[model samples]
Target: MKYFMFLIFVLLFFDAKGQCCLHTDLSRKFDYKVIRLDHKDADGFARESKIIIELYKKSDKKLFQKIQFKTEGIGLSNVFSKCSDDRSYITGQNMKTEILDGDYGDIVIADFNFDGKEDFAIKYNIPADVGPEYCYFIQGDKGFKKDEYLSNQMLWFPWLINSKKHQLISIVSPNWGTRIYKFQYNVFSKKWRKIGNRFFRHDEGLDEELIRLKNI
Candidate 1:
């Protein structure tokens, strides 16, 4: 009888749900749900993925698919948000995803360039990206804006801004050949100006050279 009771206990334990606590804020106010993996048998923990829903309140859009990515180091942490719309995805594999830490840097929505309405000024890190360590401040009005300069040999740190304006986004890809590109409607000149620093790309080895990585 004791053995039978033990079997029942094990069954109940396996049937329990794994819950992860998360607090996410979006450019538009939202409610999110986070799901993790369940161990079929008692073992340890494998990397898990989280899904954040915008809770459209009245929209019919759901995450119809997922793509997988295998990175060299820590893998893609939850740090990478749905930076763009669903159609922004550029891959065809699905894998488990998650973030070990909840800090997603500065997500302030502001008029970073002092246009008029709120733009954005998210300060995040691509510490692993090959260039110099720098925090990315991506602003958003029509699109996004990233810091022009890049640093090297980064450090492990978290950034937070005191304002409640910026809505955080991703950093410019740190791969050697990348640049922060921005398009502007110059009121004074009445012309559309595409202005920014030069791009950086990997040539052979050691020394860093400049190259264009293309626009989104």
Candidate 2:
């Protein structure tokens, strides 16, 4: 799924690198390729193309295309007004956001609270006319409820993936000029805390990653 991003970034960059704006044709490699549609922001294209590719990959084609995208960390929005900083994790940066899972696009089905059955953490698209995207944690029965988070703009960009421990990891963006956020399962605490403010690829220990981010 991570490689899914290369589709938009690489594709778009390819076009930009071209001198004349000749009608760009998809130069097929026979093997699946990553193509980014634009330079500044490929959210619109990413949102659409990613779903088709992922759906085809999961249901019909290979689980992951020839060039598998290494899933990145989750980008979270700062939902709290009092919290300050005012930033939400951006999703489209690493991967695209669209509903390949039918109703849930960038969502994970798991027992986030650890009660057993399973809960959910999903990113929502603030209406096309609204501000940036927002993420929510829905507990059993209660369903999708809004929380005070980090993201303010309505870019609604996020990607959900099951990690090595079968834990759901999300690579999300809160707002413009912000890095990604990694939310990990605190086995002992039984809750999700934003780890490694803006992360790139997967890391074994979140604590170590956070320290690295801080040092940088």
Candidate 3:
């Protein structure tokens, strides 16, 4: 019995500390790639990861630009299993990069700051209780600069981009009802501001309803 228990404990120890590392493509724009490294602490919690972005130009095969950032723990958002008596649970969260094929285009491209040039909208699943938040890269003469304005804004999951109007819409339900918030870029202030909102039923799709109502 003692040997059997020891073997089980050893297995769990390694299983909890499993690691993953890779470099993957994120967009078709000049073939941007992300280098991701995910590590877990001894207790099996996601510690942090290094995410680096590399953009290359095909003609010369030259690395044009690079961006790097570190991930911070967003805290536990999920509970997989719970102990009946104590209610302790196993939770998991990671700041991993999105896997992309040749044509899966989830990235939003728009002139968010109304500069007449295209900018990229990327979502990051930061430490959050609900869903993923968003950030953007504004196109510049050299490459792109991270927009601090949108990065500091607070928004929640189930989000969509309005490319025509340069808007970001998000929906959240804390309790029994849902609240919708629409954010638009203010060129003068160089920030995003909430422009509109509405309450809707769970059955209705927030993205679809927002598009319809905003058109009217």
Best by lDDT: 3
State the lDDT of candidate 3 residue by residue for 1-216, as single tens digits.
553354356445534533111112323345444444455678966566554556665455467788766545422322111111010001111113242211112234455566766565544444333444545677888888987766665334225556567677666654455677778876566668878777867635756775685674
Q: Please identify which of the two predictions, 2 or 3, would achieve the higher lDDT against the true structure.
A: 3
Model 2 over residues 1-216: C-alpha lDDT tens digits? 554554456456655442111111111111122222222234522221111112113233333322112111221221111111121122122123344312233333333334443333333343323233434433334333333342332124333333344233333322232244445556576555555455434433545754554444
Flag regions of model 1 displaced more than 4 Å. Answer: 1-19, 22-29, 36-127, 130-179, 184-216
- Would you list the rank order by lDDT, best first? 3, 2, 1
Per-candidate clash tally: 24, 51, 1
> What's the true lDDT of residue 70 in model 3?
56
How many backbone clashes can be found in candidate 2?
Answer: 51
Better of 2 and 3 by TM-score: 3
lDDT (CA) per prediction: 0.29, 0.32, 0.50
Rank list by TM-score: 3, 2, 1
Per-residue error (Å), model 2, residue 93: 24
Q: Estimate each model's TM-score.
A: 0.26, 0.29, 0.58
